[model samples]
Target chain A: MQYIKIPLVLAAVLILVIVFRNRQRVELRAGSRVLVLALAAIAIVSIIDPDIPQAIANLLGVTRGTDLLLYLLIVVFVLTSLGLYFRLRDTDQHLRRLVRSLAIDDAIRKDGPPRSDADLGPDSQST
Target chain B: MESGPTRRNDDVWVIVPCYNEGPVVRGVLERVREHFPHVVAVDDGSRDNSASEIAAAGARLVQHPVNMGAGAAYQTGIEFALRDPEAQIFVTFDADGQHRVEDVMAMVDHLRKSDVDVLIGSRFLGTVDGMSMSRRALLRAAVVFERMTTGIALTDAHQGLRVFRRSFARVLDLKAHDMSWASEFLTRMSEHQTSYEEYPVHVLYTDYSRAKGQRSINSVNIGVDVLINKLLRGR
Candidate 1:
């Protein structure tokens, strides 16, 4: 039990460290911050007592406490991965737009205005 | 939106998005200039003197701070061209010289006479000289993927040559900043319900173009990007 508790505590601290480290960059919303903190608390309590998940699992008709925790962890993992994926995509689009706008601005500054219609018209040259 | 100063006569501004085509860009611009002097070449942060070559050729040159990709460069050129009220017609020509000057003239003539808002150059419909078998198959596969994604049946879905009118330019808001934008352009045309026509255009496959072109495996990335863009943007 002590051996199990050691690894569980280490995992929780590692998750907290990661979340904190990336909190600024990820721009986690208020709700997400609260949810993460709550998840961390639950993880700590479950590691210490080892019965809370079992009780909850019993109410939910699950056979084992570990199984319930594992299932929950899987759900959390998927959700987190999806959240990060969306964030990365959003950042990529924002950056591309920035670069595009800069390029367009440069073109406008250099060219000033478009050429006259007669000058650029098809009548100007023949293939 | 009511009509304003944005309207003008049919003037063709050739938008050439170049990336490190230093060796051949000068000749390509010279040929294009012979027919259409109103050219805007967007240099996508080439390490070589591509920008200088474009400027020396007497065409308007736009430089990107970094290599954003061909799609972004196209958007920049389009936006720049849109600034001129007299710039009614916009032609997208490749800087690699694969596209002929005659094709652009034909497309512009067809576009003005026809009712379509956009004209796409089709290599399969016309002729692809000196094309490799593997490249031909890849382009065929691209057509399938494009039809599946955009629901617009095009013989050559990835051809860089196109003629877009003034009205179409206002509605054409391209978001793809990479090679995948070619596929996205078709999807946009379909999604916007813009009328388009595919015209036969001759494509000259050269050794330089073959080496400088998009790799075959990059087709997978384009496919995935198209899927993701369709799902996210619903286009």
Candidate 2:
């Protein structure tokens, strides 16, 4: 009966995630998808064999399963941070290209020829 | 065959794409007139007095009714320049006074001597001063990434100061509305096997230039644009 409950919960969560994935604004990246799967596995394993949580808690010198959950939350937060970092890096590259193109466009529109430092006054001269 | 001086006159049309640059538009026009006699400035629907300033400066003006991206403006300028029979080379100049006039000459010389179809300005080639450290780092990373993706070992892949031969420019199908046009250009150039040269050019990073800049956060939006255009739109 106990093993049956674990599989049932796992199936329910998987269906819920699939349904929500389509509607959610923040779609999961490949890394996040892997993390989520790993988490789901852990959740299912915990339900099927509750002693696993107690064993992890003991390994970490924690007294309760809730303490183990707290550690897992920290791990999740770290993974999310890593995901955000990669996303931001991708954004930075995109912006650099945009600025370069815009700058060139602005220059081209004004019928301006390319300018040297001598044109911008001596103070504005690039070193 | 005509002499070297006469042959030089047969090539090169300066293409300028202008937006809301009312203040310094006149200066840019005067500079181009002094150096390259044939210059065309395309006004990309500036809400400001950029168009009038361009006309007053006495350069041919191609106007777009609504504000389009730089890539669109460049395309317009190229189309107009292509109409001229004397224009054998089409050079893209920035209106913001960042690129050097001498670089255009150098690019022309390089294209004429070499078998390359396009010559791009590279700030990282020889010496680059007055660039912010953060900007330099960002640009270096982008150059590496672009080189990796396109297999083109260019020092400065995104520099807008480019000189394209009339023949190559005519065949290019540049349809990018926004900044992704630079990447698109590289992708196309590689696909078409267009020979290109990367020449060193100066980059002047002024307070005004940086102030009238896009926010760093907009990079995410640009990345999304690239992914969508490349994958979803099948471009």
Candidate 3:
């Protein structure tokens, strides 16, 4: 192992141990953490042994190892951006429901509720 | 012929989703209340005095604290109306005064007399007072898209004036929180096997309405949103 890899790998392993021990419910966060750690490990390993990524890249018909990493970075960036977008959409939906209920509750409080079904029509009376 | 109880206007709830159209909303609600007394104007975080305008028009106001889109506003209004065990019909009207209350009256009458569960007001089937070429083209393209995707033949797809019975509103379950909700509504209508028909109604475009209405370019955002939503939903 290279001089820089020694401390970096040890730190990564320690962080992974703590994360694995702490994660139980938040599967999304845990999965993302694992993916980030895996990527970081690969990056550190590539720095330590430049020929490994180059050999893999050559086998895959790529001329350079850094080019392979670039392509992967593009893919990972797109995936992460899309994941954030979907989460934002879900959070927005929840916010809408919360605001909607609050609006309805306040309206009922101020307006004294909608008129009863007796005088309106047969529809509500039947229900 | 059997005698069925004629539906009254008090049972219909007109859900006017107002954003910043403070100037014209009160006038529209006034005309709407002339025919249908129970009008619920949903104020979608308008910076203007639309809430007071709604109150001034004698319509009940349900207000969003933050600026949710028109779809969210309409959904809030629908939910608020649904609370009243008395509400039997739900009408989604624009607050910018493009929609005519006369058309609402006619559509409500048609829905009551017929077996249709939803009456969608179509400008193509009726008349347009003033329409730009690009606006008309965009609307036509949206119709074609709806036709190909949902296989639901409609002359107009994104018209804001829609009247549906309370029974349909109860199970609407709209997911889109923005203008994309229009397409989502059509999508769900097919899934629900709703008995729907298009009614010819006049749509008049004014300077204020044009300024306040959505840009046709937002259709691109709506398309992406719908596609991504479908993909994420895995349906």
Candidate 4:
């Protein structure tokens, strides 16, 4: 019963992911899918062979498998936080680029005259 | 500064893509208004007063109700420029003030004389004074990566300061919604066999721009997207 519970939960999660993917509103990338599959596979393997959890716990200097699960969750959370940080940084860069583009376009729109070619230095010329 | 030969006015449309740039949007728009008469600012669903500020600056504004990626905003601006009969050339300028107003003329001149469809700005071509060493190195690495991946020789592959002729701009199917759009643009140019040039330009990295700079990890995300686009999207 204990072994069956892990696979059953994983199967449920997989089904849910598939259903969400089929809706097409939010499609997971192949890399993300692979990550999810790997996670599920690890969960299944740990369930089928109870010794795996004990080994992980011993490796981590923990006495209980539950402690191992807790450590794993903490690691996952840390990674998720790192991912979010990167995402926000990307958003900030995109915003700045957009703002700069708008500013230059605005400048050109207000001034009707073409800039003199002499204004641009020789080094500025396109190759 | 020695001036190059002047080109016709009908050949270029300067595109500015903005998002929530309420404070400085007015100034940037005003500058564009003064220099490039044919300017289009695509408001990428700015949550603030960006769209209104752009409209107030006397430039044509294309508003996206929600914030799409910079790539989407550029595509919107390009579509607007392509619709105009006078827009024979399209230039992508940032809403921030990193790119100089004078550099646009140089790019346009190069595009007009050379048998090329695209002109990119290269900060490394000449002396780069105001940029940080870290940024300079990172940008150089990105350029090398792009050259290896796309087989296009460019001094600055990711610079936003670029000019494209109508013939090349019209055929581009730029689908990337994020910063990877820059790479996607290069990939499209390579696929279409569009002629291109790299022009040297000054990149002013102000405190504001530095604060808004992307972390190095985002480059990894962009790299992943590039690989996916090339391998999966088959671009």
Candidate 5:
């Protein structure tokens, strides 16, 4: 138990530091900031008294505190990463659209307006 | 025989998104032009001579610099049409020569008479010749999935031929940039409460079209895309 406490506390502190550093690059919303704080508080409490997480896990049907924390952390990490992945994909799509639109605009300008056949008598075939 | 009164050809825009279909797209454009002269073909960065063929066919051509996907091409065409006040009806047609012009005419006719916002061509309701048994099963599964997610029981949820009124077209800002757009379109239709009707339409599944159509395994990817879209939109 003593050996596990040192590693767990170190890991929790490392996560906090990484998250703090990430905050400089990404502006954490109020809800996310509160969530991070709560997670940090839980980590600190669990490191101080390892039995607390174990008791809660026993109540929740999970056997071990480490196992429960690991499960929740994996789930949250997966969901958050998925969310960020989707956001990055969407931004890429928008950027691609912007570039495509620019290319289309250039083509349209060079070829002239893509008017309907009814509007084009003889000049529309120039493109 | 004429079914009902249809809108004038001048007011409608036939949007065909062509990608590496240089061989057949011109023929499709010509057939569509016979009925509706207002045609726009968005060439999705085809390395082939599709742009030249589409331009030669006399359809209005919008060239994307790279392959942006069919949904993006449709968005470009719809946006282009909406820029003009004269464009009333927007019909999304395929470049693979599968969709029939008569079906589009009938859909436009229905749109003109009914108060519906859009008309979707249902191959299940009509004839879909040469469709493999596995493909049919896949399509049926897709219909069931779409029904479960969108609460809209469509006979052919993945059909490419859809006619949208200018108003409804303006309302539908499509987000999906791939084959998933077909499924996402239904979700949006449900989300916007867009009044839609399914019309029977013949689909000629030629060897070329079957080869070009979506593979059965891609259906799972489409389902995931729809789920992600719903999640991202917080719906």
Candidate 6:
């Protein structure tokens, strides 16, 4: 069996970047399990038949199967990071609104609710 | 309690963001309460007795259930204060006993007299007490960085003391949850074309504040957050 060096290196880097997210996050636990299974199957098939990747690489005008895998891996890694980053930010924003409303509601409840007249006032920040 | 030359403006609502500052916050609030009749303090999930201290100081207390950053605390306090239709001016103060009531009074006066939308307190333009050389250098670097990045011509990069008209606050929304909020505020001011002025304000750097202040390394995190956020906005 011939040694494939590049995909191993690419996979190693990919593993290092996203391993923590797959392990400790309960928020994404359900989705990650399915992702793990799918990735495992793809990795297995790619390892079992290197010629399949080579043929696809030839179709895509790539010289080596490992190089194509590396390119795809880099693209996937970046896309995953960007998607997760924005999702986490959105979740944070939602949590902030939740906590803020609870705090403000508690304050208003005890301190006599703000006069209802101001409710119809033109407050542009409400948007 | 009302002995000093109180600029007791009922139209002004002072917003204090209190985080784990149980010991020093009461004194700070007391000083602030002397000048301003209306005060809103948001305790950002303090582990200590800051909430009770704020209540004891007679400031309206808003408590976050969990620890949000100082920026979020300020936003919560501002939104709470904005509920009052009578409130015409809004002020942001630090809970670390740094900001002076006099500086706030001066800034509020400036905001009221001038046509500017917001008045930001600048220690470099005034006096910073007990600041170390290295911290001063870091802050100056931040000012330069702010000017280069946002071109707002600010003398100070991160200061808690600010006064803005109710009109400005009505159109203001802050997105950053942490130290990056200072930059977010600047960007918003520029984006909205909000007229602004810098007031010479005094900042006291005590041993307690030194312990509580952010580390220089945190600037790296703020830079990354702002950069990625700007990218996400496609600007």
The prediction achieving the highest lDDT against the true structure is 3
Q: For model 6, what fraction of the real interface contacts is kept?
A: 0.42
Q: For residues B1-235, what per-residue lDDT tens digits would candidate 6 score against the true structure?
A: 2433333476788999999999999999989877776788999999999999999987889999999898899899889988987789999888998888889888887888899989999998999889889878888888887786677888898887889988878777777899888888888887788999889999988889889989988988988887766544531
Which ten-residue region of model 4 chain B has the weakest summed lDDT?
B1-10
Please give the CA lDDT of all the candidate structures. 0.82, 0.70, 0.83, 0.73, 0.82, 0.82
lDDT (10s digit) by residue, model 2, range A54-97: 99999878999888898789867865674565466446446534
Q: Pick the candidate with the highest DockQ.
A: 3
B95-172 per-residue lDDT for model 4 (tens digits) = 877778778877887778898788889888845656778777888889888988899988887789998888888887
Mind sharing the TM-score for model 2?
A: 0.62
Order of candidates by TM-score, top first?
Answer: 3, 1, 6, 5, 4, 2
**Model 3 agreement with the true structure over B50-103: per-residue lDDT tens digits:** 999999998889989999998888899899889878789899999999999889
TM-score on alpha carbons, each prediction? 0.81, 0.62, 0.84, 0.64, 0.77, 0.80
Better structure of 2 and 3 per TM-score: 3
- Model 5, B66-98: lDDT tens digits are 888888888888877776577889999999999
Residue B95 of model 2 has an lDDT of 85
Q: What pairs collide in candidate 6?
A: none
The positional error of residue A70 in candidate 1, measured at the CA in angstroms, is: 5.0
Model 4 deviation from the true structure expressed as Cα RMSD, one decimal place:
10.9
DockQ of 6: 0.23
Docking class of 2: incorrect
The candidate scoring highest on TM-score is: 3
- DockQ of predictions, in order shown: 0.26, 0.04, 0.27, 0.05, 0.17, 0.23
Q: CA lDDT of B177 in candidate 2?
A: 67
User: Candidate 4 at B176: error in angstroms?
Assistant: 0.6
Chain B TM-score, model 6, reads: 0.94
Better of 4 and 5 by lDDT: 5
